[model samples]
Target chain A: MSFKDILNSGKFVVTAEVGPPKGTDIKEMIHHIELLKGKVDALNVTDNQSAVMRICSMAVCRICLDHGVEPILQMTCRDRNRIGLQSDLLGASVLNIKNVLCMTGDHVLAGDHKQAKPVYDLESVQLLGVVNSLNNGKDMSGNDLRGATDFFQGAVVTPEANPLEPQLIKFEKKVKAGAKFFQSQAIYDINRFKEFMKYARRFPVKMLAGIVVLKSAGMANFINNNVPGIRVPQELIDELKAAGKEKALDTGLNIAARHIKQLKDENICDGVHIMAIGMEDKVPIIMERAGLL
Target chain B: MIITKKRELQELMENLKNYKSFFLIGCSECASLCGTGNQEAIDSLTESLKAEGKEVTGGFVPKTGCQVLGTKVELKPFKEALDKSDCILVMSCGAGTQAAVEIFEDKPVYPTNDSLFLGNMTRFQMFDERCSLCGKCILDKTGGICPVTACPKGILNGPCGGCKDGKCEVSPDIKCAWVRIYERMKRLDKLQELCDTVLEAKDWSQNIKPRTLATRPEKKEEKKK
Candidate 1:
C-alpha cells in the first residue's frame, strides 16, 4: 500500500523496521523483508543506527521495493552535508522510495570509533525545511533544482520524556516545517502516551506511536534510565521482571501486543511503529496477537 | 572543530529550570563542519525549546564563529533576540562558543558541545581526527601524505610490522599510512629513494604539540606594538 493510503485508511496502521546488514550480505535483510511484506503497511530501513558502518539504507529500501514492500527510508543529517543530503533525496525520488524520515542521528562518539568527526551541515528540522524547499523546486541556498520532489516527509518525536512540552512544540514546528507524519521514540507507558496524544492531536500531522519490544525487564529499565527521553513505567518493568528468563521474549511480545491494542482501542495515534530491535521475526506474531493481521 | 551531540532538546529543557528566554545560536562554518551547530540543529533546538514551555525569544543566526565578518552580520539580526534572552545556548565549537561569549559579554553563554578538534568525516558516520597542526609540516618527504597525521599510531620512520596486507592493524578497512606513502611515492616514480636514504628518527621537540595560529591580524599588530 502507498504510505498516503495507509495514513488515510483510518485503520490502525502497522509499520516495522528492517536494519540494513553490516556487510554486503543481503540474506538476513532479504529474510526480514520477506517476513514483513504484506504483513505490515510499510517498512522503515534505518541508516547506520548508532553510527556503526552498515550497508546504505537506500540500497536496502530498493531491495524491499523490488520485493513489493513500501519502504520508509530513514535519512540522517549526521554523515552527509546539505549538498549530499539534497542529492540523496533526489536519488530516493528516482528509486521510488516514497517515505523519508529525517533525523539528526546519533553522534560519531556514540558509535564504536572514539575519534570520529561529524558533519552537521543540516539537522533534522532544517532538513525538513530543505526538503520542503526542494519540493518547491529550490535548494536550501534558494537555487533551483532540475526537477521537484514530492516526498511524504516524516520526522521523529519522543513522547515519554519527563518534560513533554518540547516534544509537543517540536511536533508543531515539524508540522510547520512540512512534516506530514511523526514516528515517536518507543512508548512504554500507556498513560503517558495518552497524555502525549492529547497534545499531539491538536497538530495536523499523523503520529505512529512507537512500540519497542522489551527483551527483558533489565533492557526496559536500561532504556528508561540510560536512553534520554524514554521512560518505561514501573508497572511494565515489574510485569517483564515477573516473566523470568525463559518467558522474557513471551512477556515482551505480550507487552507490545497490549500497547498496540490500547493505542488502537483508544484511537491514540494514526499508526504504530513496531520496533523489535534484533527480534524482527517476532513482529509478525505480535501483530497477529494485536489482531492487526 | 570538535563534534558533539547536544543533550536532546527535551533533556536540555529539564536541565534549564531557571532560564526563561534564551538565544539559540548556530555556526555557519566549522560547527557545521563538525556536524553540531548549523541551521538544522538550531531549528531542532528552537522547536524543542518552544515545546518545553520556555519562550524562545531568539531565532537562528548562522555565523562563521571564527571571523568577525559573519559574527558582525549575525549580531545585528540576533541583537534583539540576545537582549530578550536570559542565556545563550551556543551550538558551535569552542571558538564559536567563545565568540558568542565575547559578543554577549553580560549574557550567560553555554556550550552545547565539548569542542574537540579539527577532524574529517570518515566512512560509516565515523569522524577521524586527522589534523593535529604540530606547527611544522613534512608533506614534502612523504609525497603529499603525512604519516604523522594519517597513521593511527603516529609512527614516522617506517611502517610497523603490525601492518597486515597494506591495512592498519588498528582498523582493517583503513589503509596503512606507510602503504599509502609507498603508493604515492611509487606513482611519482620516487620509489628508488626507499633504498638510498636511511631517514633518522623524527625529533620529538621540533613537532612540539600545542600550536596556535592567530587569524586576527589586528591582535598580531597590537602584539607587535
Candidate 2:
C-alpha cells in the first residue's frame, strides 16, 4: 500500500527502523526487513546514522522493496551536497522507492573517522526545499529537469528535548517545507509527548513517536547521558536496573511495549517507529506484547 | 600541470628533512587544480612524516607558490624546520618554483617536475592540460578550438600548408586544430569568417611579466572591522 494510504487509514500504523550492516553482508538486514515486512506499515533504512558508515541506504531499501516490504529511505545532509542529493532522489524515484526521511545528520567529529569532510551544502530545511523544488521539475540551481519526483517526504523531530519550543518551531518549518510526516526521537515520557502532540495537531503532518528498544539499564543510562534530546526518566532506568542481569532483554522489550501501549491508548501519535538498533529480532515480540501484532 | 604520486611525496619529504630546515610548501591554484598539493595532500604528507620518526615542522599555505603574494606572507610558522633545514620542497608548478626562489632568495628551491601546459580536469584521478593560453580566443569563431593553443607549432594561418589527408605534421592522433576548426565552422555555416582575418604574431608581453597582486582596501577593512 502507498505510504499516504497507510497514514490516512487512521489506524495505529506500526513502523520500524532497520540499520544496514557495516559490510556487504545483507543477511541480518534482510532477516529484519522480512520479519517486519507485513507486520509494520513501513521500515526506515538509516543513512549512516549516529555518524557511523554502513551499507548504502538505497541498496538496503531496494532489498526491502524486493522482499515485498515498504521502505522509508532515510537521507542525511551530512555527506552529500544538493547536487548529489538531487541525483540520489531522482535515482530513488526511478527505482520506485517512495518514502524518504530527511535529517541534518550527526557531526562528522562524532563518527569513527573524525577526519572525514562534511558536505553540508544544504541543511535539513534546505534539503526539504530542494526536494520540493525537484517535485516542481527544477534542481537547486534553477536548472530544469527532464521529469519530476513524487516522494512521500518525511522529517525527524525530538519531542523529549528540554525547552521543546525549538523543536516545535522546526516542526512547523518542516511542514511548511513539504514534510508530509515526522518520526520523533525515542520517547520515554508519554505526557511530554502528549504536550508535543497538542502543538503538533495544529499542523497537518502525521507523526510517529520513536520507541527505541532499550537493551539494558546501562543502555538506557548511556542514551540518557550521551544522546541529546532523548531522556529516559529515572523511574524507567530503575525498573530496568531492578530487572536483574538475565532478564535485561525482556525488561527492555517490556518497556518498549509499555511505551507503545501508552502512545496507542492515549492517541498521542499516529504511529510508532520501533528502533531496536542491533536487536531487530525482538521488535515483533515488543509489538505482540503491545497488542499491535 | 605537474602530478606527484603519494610515494614521490614521501621521498620529497625525506629529502627536504635530510637537507636544511625544510618548509613543505603547497600551492592553492595549480596544485589544487591538479589535486596533488592541496590541504588534503599536505595533511597526508604530515602524517607520513610523523609515522617515519621525524619531527618536521611545516604548514600549508594557499595560492600558487610561484606567485609573489604567497611568497611575501610569513612562512615563519614553519620556522623550526626552515631555520634548521636547508631547502624547501615546494609542491607547485614551475611558477611556484620562481615564487619560492624569489621569497627565500638564498635558500635552495627544488622543483618536483617541469610545469606543463593548461589542461582540462578529466576526473578526480586524472588531469590533461591541452591548452597553451594563446592570446586569442577563437572558440566562438571556430567552434571552441584554439588553433594557436592546441597546434604544437602554434599554426594560425593554415594546416601547416602541408595537408597529408587532414592529419597534422606533429602526430596522427593530434588532429590539426585548424582542420577541426574549419570543419566545425563549415558545419555551423560560419566558414566564411575563418578566411576573412589574417592573424598577426602574438605579443609575448601579455604573459611574460610577473603577475601583480591587488586587494581592495574596503574588502580588507570590512574583514578586519
Candidate 3:
C-alpha cells in the first residue's frame, strides 16, 4: 500500500529507512530492499546520508519501485542549489516517486567531504514551501511548469534537541510550509517523546515516532556524543552494557520492539519510523515481536 | 560596524614593489578598534616602507574613512605628498578602501586589510559577527539573535540534527547559534509565542545588490535650496 493511503487509513503505519551504498555496487542494498519489501509500508532511501557521498536516493527509489516497494525519496539541501533541487524534485515526480522527506542535511564538515561546498540555497523549512509551490503548479521562482508535481512531502523534527524552543518553532513552520507528516530524530526517552507529543498533538500533521535501534552501550554513547537532537537515556545504555558484547544486538532489538509496542498500544502518535541502520533484515522480526506483523 | 584584518605583510610588500612612493590612509572608527587602522599600525607600515627604501610621502588616520566629503577635506593639507605618491594604500575595510578609490580616481588604490563582517566588539581586539545584513531582519522572531550570521549553515529555523554537545558540527568551539537563541527565548518567556508563528522564507529582495539607504534625503534637498 502507498504511504499516503496507510496514513489515511487510521491504522498504525510502519516505515523503515535504507541508505544507498557509497559505491555503484548495490548487491547488499538490493538484498535489504527485498527483505523489507513486504514488511514496511514504505522505505526511505537516504540521500548522501550524514553528508557522506553515496548513490543518490532517487536512483535507489527507482530500484525500490522495481522491487514493488514504495520508496520515500529523502532530499537534502547540502549538495544542490534551489535550481538544482527543483529540477531533481521534478525528476523524482516524473519517475513516479511520490513521497519526499525534505531536510536541511548535516553540514559537510560532519561527513567525509569536508572540502565540498555546501549549497544550502533553501533550508528545510524553505524546501517545504518549495514543495508546496510545486504542487500548486509553480516553481519556487513562480515560473510556470510544463508538468508540476504532486508530492506527499514530509519533514523531520528533533524533539530532543537542546533548548527545544527553536526546534518547536521550526516544527510549526514545517506544517505551515506544507509538510503532511513528520519523522522525528532518534528518540530513546519515552517520557521525553511523550512530552514532545503534547505539543505535536496540536498540529494537523501526522507524526511518526522515530526509534533508532541501539546495538550496544558503545553505540548508544557514540550516538549521544556525536549525533545532535538524539539522546539515549542512561538506563538504556546501562541495559545494553549489561547485555554484554555477544547478546548486545539481540538486546537492542528487544529495546526497539518494546518502544514500538508502547508507541502502538498507547496511541501516542500516528505511527513509527524504525531506523535499523545496517540491520534492515531485523526490522521484520522487531515488527513480529511488537505484534505488528 | 564593520571588521577588518590586515593582509599579510608579505602580500603588502609585494604590492608595493612597483610603487616607488606611497600615501597611506587609515580610519579612526572600526579599523582602529580592530587594530588595523590605528596610529601604531600606520606608523609601523610607514617605518616598514621606509626600511624597504620606498618613499613614504605621508600617512594619516582619518576620522571616518567612508565619509568621502569629510575625508576629502581632511586630505587637502596632504596634497603635495599625495601628488608625489604613486599609489594610495588604505588600511581599513573595503568601504574605506573604496573611499580612497573614489577620491583619487587618477591614482591606483589598494587595500591593506581584508574587509570582514558587520559585528560587535566582544572584547579587547576581539569581534564577533552579529548581523548578516540579509536585508530582512528577523531578530524580533528569533529572540534577537541573527541566525543569518550566527548559524554556520545560516539556517532560518535550525540547530540541525548535526549539532552535538550544543556546538556546531563545523567546530567544537563554535557553539550552535540556534541553541543560544532557544535559551534566550526561553529566558525571555517568548518561547510559547513561537508555537504557532513560523518565520517564513526571508524576502531575499531586501538583500539585493548595491543596497543603498539615504538616511536624510530631505536634508540634501534642503541643502540644495
Which has the greatest lDDT?
A: 3
**Model 2 DockQ class:** incorrect
Clash tally, candidates in order: 7, 12, 0
lDDT of 3 by residue, B1-225 (tens): 799999988898888788899999999999999999989999998888888898888988999999999999999999999999999999999999989999999999999999989989988989999988888788888889887788878887756766666788788888888888878877988777655555666677787899889775467667788
Instruction: Determine which window of 10 residues in candidate 3 chain B has minimal summed lDDT.
Output: B193-202
In angstroms, how far off is B87's CA in candidate 2? 4.3
lDDT winner between candidates 1 and 2: 1
Q: Which tens-of-lDDT digit does each residue in B108-214 have in candidate 1?
A: 87777666666777753357767666555767777777766686545444453234455554566778776787777778888655333333334445555455556
Worst 10 residues of 1 chain B by lDDT: B194-203
Local distance difference test, each candidate: 0.76, 0.74, 0.89
Best by DockQ: 3
State the local distance difference test value for candidate 3: 0.89
Q: Candidate 1: deviation at residue B43, Å?
A: 50
CA deviation > 4 Å runs, candidate 2: B1-225
Of candidates 3 and 1, the better by lDDT: 3
Q: Quality of candidate 3's docking, in CAPRI categories? A: acceptable
Model 1, A1-293: lDDT tens digits are 58778797786789999998788888887998999889999999999887787889999889999999999999987688778999999999899888999876765656765477666556666678878888899987778888898888998887765434323444555677789998988888888788878878888888998988988899987876567566788888888889898998799899899889889988989989988888899999999898788
- List residue ranges in candidate 1 displaced over 4 A: B1-225
